[model samples]
Target: MKTTKRVIVLAVLLAAVVSGCGEVTVESETTSTGSASEEKSAVAEKSEEASKASDSEVKAEEPTAEESAAEQPAAEEPADTATLGEKNALASAQNYLRFAPFSAQGLREQLEFEGYSSEEVQYAVEHIDADWNEQALKSAQNYLRFAPFSAQGLREQLEFEGYTSEEAQYAIDHCDADWNEQAAKSAQNYLSLMPFSKQELIDQLIFEGYTREQAEYGVSAAGY
Candidate 1:
């Protein structure tokens, strides 16, 4: 009977040990599964946070509409209010220059005659492109075509036409005219208009700005 009892106790202990081992194994497996699920959750959360951070950085890198507009170039400014007047004056000056050569003073006078203000006339004259010496030369040529002129007479006439003394002298120096011939022509023109004594012709030529030697040459050449 004791042997039978011992065997029954030992069998019960063995079954208990097996059941405890089974419980321990099931608990360990459940713990490992829960840990793996937690790990996966943590990794997914980290990936989502990184994605969100990347999106935020991209948004920060891009400029807004207002900032983009500010970065563009500004528009050009308008022209000055007096620009039209200046242009008109410049055009008028150019047109005047195209028609005839003029001294600076003469051009200013012409502009003034056209009813422009003194300031505007001065501006036009200052801005016009012309060589005063060349203008003087042209004036001299024009005068010689219509009438004879002594060197001094021509220079005076040029000065009267608004050329500076220096400019008038330049024209006279470059005219390539023969003063004796000019004096002779003047004498002839005077004789054609009315008869005159030799002394009277000579005196008249002198009064007309001829030198003494030129006057004598003119009277002698005219058979006086």
Candidate 2:
């Protein structure tokens, strides 16, 4: 009976140890599973934070192509209008000069107030083809027809009308005017009304810008 009791106690002790070992293994497995779950949750949270940061950076940088184009032309249109107006003024000034031949300097000042470029004004002046000599002759003829003038007086008038010295001289030389005859007729007409001395007549003619020889010839021919 003693031997049988000892065997039964040994079997009971073995069974208890096996049960304890099984319980320990189960607890270890549970702890490992909990640790894995915690690590997965932490990784997922980190991934979400990184994705949010990337989205925020993309939103903060760079405008859209349409927005960029709109900003550029909104600033450029007014500048283009200013440039176009300037060009139009210069072109108009040039076209106007074709009908009226103004002096280069005179036209330049007029065009400047009208907003023309200096180069455009210069180009218009250089391209004019008006006959200055013919203009001078016509001017001389007009003065002689309206107001009787001596050669020197007519020269002054032509000069005032913007004719060059050579051009004025040419017009005076070419006109069909007889200076001596004209002077005699004037002197006779004056002496007919108011009897003037020979010296007084000469002085009057000279004061009218006649040459000394022309005045003397005129007085003698007038029988004064």
Tens-digit lDDT track of model 2 for 47-81:
99999999989987778888889877544443433
TM-score of each: 0.61, 0.43
Angstrom error at residue 87, model 2: 13
Tens-place lDDT per residue, model 1, 1-224, is 99999999999999999999999999999999999999999999999999999999999999999999999999989865544555566578789778776778888787777777777776666666678999899889889888999999999999998999999999999989999999999999999999999999999999999999999999998887
What's model 1's lDDT at 151?
96
**Each candidate: RMSD to true structure?**
12.4, 17.8
- Evaluated against the true structure, the overall lDDT of model 2 is 0.74
* Cα lDDT, model 2, residue 154: 82
Candidate 1, lDDT over the whole model: 0.89
| CA lDDT of every candidate | 0.89, 0.74
